[model samples]
Target: MLRAHTVEDVRRAEAAAMADLPDGALMQRAAAGLAAAVVDLLDGAYGRRVVLLVGPGDNGGDALWAGARLAGRGARVEALLLADRVHAGGLAALRAAGGLATRDPDDLSAAPDLLVDGIVGIGGRPGLRPEAAAALARFPAVPVVAVDVPSGVDVDTGRLDGPHVRADLTVTFGTHKVAHLVDPAATASGALHLVDLGLDPDELGPPALEALQPDDVRALLPRPGPDAQKYTRGVVGVRAGSGTYPGAALLAVSGAGCGLVGMVRYLGPEHIADTVRTAHPEVVGAGRVQAWVVGPGGGDDAGSMLAEARADGVPVVVDADALRHVDAPMPGCVLTPHAGELAAMTGVERAEIEADPLHHAREAARRWDCVVLLKGHHTLVADPAGRVRVTTTGVPWLATAGAGDVLAGLVGALLAAGLEPYDAASVGSWVHGAAATEASAGGPLTAGGVAVQIPRLVRATLNPSGSRPLE
Candidate 1:
């Protein structure tokens, strides 16, 4: 799992580590790592024109020290000090190594190949200072390498309010920050590189956000035992689709039939049911199921389908149109909604939800007292108690029609396999994303194509050595 700690957590960890080290040792370690990353990005430091946007704090210190190292290695490093009070020691070191420092923006005759943003650290507010923003505007086309994080991003909240550096690559220290993984800020933070400070993971306590890796998902997957039979694995029931959207039922069942569960039982109109049976001949009509997936393309019949699914007293995956009928607490259910659907249910604007999805997803889970899966570029599965898992594995091709329908059925399969709502939603989302990536193969993707690719993706994940790459 990729765990993202808050700004406060990183501060505490840094302070603790600094206490054990000699004076300036920790900063040197960070600087060495930062310089190494920059050199790697430039292919070589020799003769590369590197510009540093220096600020007042330790973030600027890291960049100054790194600039010194780059200068020593033959890179022409120039620092534009954006703040009145800069890190004195770091500036001295850069000057000693033959790097140029200037307070003026137009001092440089030519733009550098790469821009380093050391304008603000994790401690600063969400918006950039006028000087820093102006300095950044001078080099509009240059690819940026942000120190720790892209300056001016809300480190803890992942919100981008005002002027902030858009880094092509951000070199983060120790653990991942919330801004690096969560969206909005994450969008500005192009690519990430972590530099370990040897901090204890146990000391960090719980993370603010967690993203599941392939190994983590592999461990969460359910495998049948020696004595397992078809019924022994688990059965998932689908109560989705209507006359108007018969394809929704087909898409959902396609995901359910990816072999995660023992059986798939879809309940809808006779014509649609027959269509589903024809598409997936292995599917059976409605019977007792361990879990239920309700309300994909359900239209006006969503309320009634939700009522019947609730009567079964099993864990349910509530999605699409059925999200509207959820008024009270649903302890064991998972509610999956896109930004617009969530906004409708909570009376907030879709734009508001998209701006800070982490906050809105958590708030919705708390409000409904159920697991909430807010689908987006980065899918978040937030539990009622406040834990969240963000799935960042999908390709942009996943925006096709009926994708959510496929995801709903996949989550229901995991729920039927006896995973908790949180685990089921997150794990299923991760797998769904991975399947989409495999399906896309750099071209347009279809909803049914995602379902077809699930088995291949899961096989490759669990058995990486011999399996083909999803790409």
Candidate 2:
């Protein structure tokens, strides 16, 4: 799992580590790591031109010291001091290493190979200073390597309120900040490289957010035991689609039949059910099921489907048209809502939800008393208890229609297989996103293509020996 800590947590850990270490030790370690990362980007330090955007605090100090190291290695380094009061010791070291320092932006005449953004670390607010903005505007094409975080992002909330440096590479120390994992800000943070400062894991407290890796998903995925039978594995029921949208029924059943569930039962309008049967011959009429997936293109009957699914007293995955009918939390229910659907549930604007997804998703989870899966570029699964798992896999091609229908059925199958609401939602989302990437293969894909790819993706994860790259 990729854990993202808040700024306060990082500050507390840094303070504790600094209290025991000698003077300047932490900064030196950070500087060394930052310099090494920049060296790797440049490939060879000698004769390369590097520019440092230095600010007032320790962030700027890190850049200055790193600039000093680059200068020592025969790189031409220039420091553009953006603040009136800079780190005096760091400036002296840079000067000692033959790095030029200037307060004027015009001193930077030619484009450098790389720009180091050390202005406004995790401590600063969302927007950039006028000087910083001007300096950034001067070099439109220069690739930036941000120290700790890209300057001016909301380090705690992952919100981007104003202009911030968009980094090509971010070399963060200690641990990942919330901005590194959460979107909007995460999109600005190009590629992340963590440099360990040896902070104790206990000191960092709990993570603000987490992204499940492949191994984490593998551990959570349902696997049959030696004595397991078809019935024991689990059965998932689908109550989705209507005669008006029979394709939704077929897509949902396709996802449920991905082998996550031993059986898939479909209950819907007669015409849609017939269509589902023809497309997925393995699907049967409604019967006993361990869990239910309700409401994708369910039309006017969505309310009845939700109520019936809730009456079963098993976990349910509520999605699409059923979202508005959800007045209170259902026991063991997972609510999947896109920005617009979430807006309708919470009475907030869709734009606002998209702007700050983490806050809105958590609020909805608490309000509805269930696991809320807010779909987006980075899908978020928030439990009522406040824990969150972000889905970091997927391509832009996944924005096509019918994707959510497939995801709802897949999650319901996992829930039937006995994974908790949180795990089922998180793992289902991870696999859904990964399957989209596999089906796309750098091109376009339909909802059916994505659904068909899920079993292959699951099989590869379940048996690594038979795995090959998806094309």
Candidate 3:
């Protein structure tokens, strides 16, 4: 699992670590890691041009010290001080190591091969200062390596209010920050690298967010035991689509039948049922099921389908048109909603929900008393108690239609497989996104294609022979 802590938690952990160590120990560790990461980015330390955007706080100190290290290894490093008062000790060290420090950006003869952004730390508010913004604008094309975090992003909320440094790579110390895992800000953070600061995990408290890796998903997946039978493996029921949109039923059933559930039960209009059975002949008529997936192109009968599914007294994965009918959270229910659907449920504007997805998703989960899976670039699966798992495996090509329907069915299958609502949602989301990536393969993909790739992804995850485990 890739766990992300809040700014306050990181601060507390840092303070705890610093109390027992030397005054400059933590900074030295961070600087060493930062410099090493920069060297890797540059492919070598010798004869390379590097620019440091230095600020007033410890973040700037980290950059200055890292620049000193680079200068020691023969890199042409320069620090463009953006603050009125910078870290004096770090500046002195840089100067001693043959790195030039100047308040003027124009003192640099040319654009450096890479830019190091240490202008603002996690505690800094969103949006860039004038000087920092100007320096970034000057070298717009240069790739950036952010220390701790990309400056000007909300470290706690992962929201980008205005101009923020978009880093090609972010080297975070101690642990991952909320901005590194959540969306909008996460989109700005290209790739993430963690450098251990040796902080005590006990002081960090619980993580603000968690992301499931392949191994985590593998461990959570419901695999058949030696004595397992078909009934013991679980069955999932699908109540989706109608004559108007029979494709939704086919797609939803396709996802449910991707080897997660032992059997798929179809419960819809005869025409849609026929279509589902034709596409997925293994699907049987409506019968007893461990879980039911409702909504998703149910058209005029979505509310009825949801009502019937709830009456079954089994876990349900609610999606699409059925979301509007949800007043109170049902027992063992997972509500899947995109921004617009979430807006409708919460009575917030879609733009507002999109702007602060974490807040809204949590609010909806708490208000409805269910696991709310808010689908987007980074899918959020939030439990009623505010625990969240972010899915970060999909590509941009997954924005195709009927994708959510497929996800709904996939999650329902996991629910039937005996996973709790939170685990089921998180695991299903990870698989859904991974399957989308597998199907896309750096190109366009349809909803059906994503569904079809689920079994393949599951096979690979269950039997990862030589592949590296997801971190």
Candidate 4:
């Protein structure tokens, strides 16, 4: 899993590391890594011209140290101080290593091979200062590499406020930060690289969210014994589809992983169920089920399955129409709501949720006492306890009509296979996103196409080899 820590958490980790290490040791290590990355970017560092935009903090210190290293490698490097005062030791080290420091406004327009943005780091707001903004505007087309988190971005919330520098690449120290994974600011970070400072995991604490790796998903997958039959794997009951939207049920069942699902039980309209059976012969009429998936396209009849699933102690995935039916707290329930549905569920405006999705998702999860999955660019899975996971993989092409249905079905399969409500939702979201990426391949894709690609993508995740293991 790829873990991401908050800005405060990263600062705490840095403090702990600096306590044991020498005064300038961590900055030196950071500079070394930064210098190596800059050198690799250029075909050869021999005679390349590099410009450093230095501010007044450790970020500027890092740039000065890196500039000194580049000078030793025979590169023409210049540091332009954006502030009156800079890191004293860093400036002295740069001058001692045969590097030139300047405060010339005329040289700001000079087009260099690379520009290093050291104006601000994690301890910065969204907007840039007047002078800093003017300096950045002088070179509109330079390829810039950011030292830490991109300057002028909300390191904690990932929200954008005013003028911000757009970097072609960002090299962050320690582990990943919240801005690197979240949107708005994340869009400004073109490419990312992590520079490890040997931070302790305990100091970093548990990550805010993580994207499950293939091995992680494989380990979490359930297995059946030799004597196991169809029912042992688990049955997923789906109460989706109406006369108006029979295709929703078909797409949901299509995306449901067949290997992990013992059988699919249909509990809806006869005509719609017949259509589902014809498309997928393995599905049968409703009977006993281990889990339930409610409201893909059941516009009005979505609420009936809540009592049914609750009484049976089966985990339930509620989506679309069922979102409107979430009247009270239901145990073992996972509610998947888009911005509109979330607004309806919370009786708040949709714009409010869109403006600040992290806060809204957590609120919904708490109010309903269930797992809430908020759909957006970064899909957030929040449990009733307030823990959250964000999925950042899927392509924009996956935003089609039946896409939510497919995701809902995938979660149902996970729930049936024995996972906690939050894990099943989060892992299902990760797989759904991965499958969409595999199907799109940088091109356009339909919801049905994403569902069709699930089996191959899921199998690849489980075994990685060409063959599947015995269940």
TM-score for each model: 0.98, 0.97, 0.98, 0.93
Cα lDDT of model 4 by residue, 112-217, tens digit: 8998999988887788999888878887888889998788988877777899888898998988887777666777776888898999999999987666667777
Q: TM-score of predicted model 3?
A: 0.98
List the candidate 2 regions with Cα displacement exceeding 4 Å: 465-471
Where is the poorest 10-residue window by lDDT in model 1?
462-471
- Give per-residue CA lDDT, model 2, range 134-230, as digits (tens): 9999999999999999998999888998899999999999999888878788898989999999897899999999999988988888987778887
- Give candidate 1's root-mean-square deviation (CA, Å): 2.1
lDDT score of residue 38 within candidate 3: 93
| lDDT assessment of candidate 3 | 0.92
Task: List candidate 3 segments past 4 Å from native.
Answer: 466-471
Instruction: Kindly provide the TM-score of model 4 when superposed on the true structure, using C-alpha atoms.
Output: 0.93
TM-score of 2: 0.97
In Å, residue 112's CA in model 2 sits off its true spot by 1.3
lDDT of residue 300 for candidate 1: 96
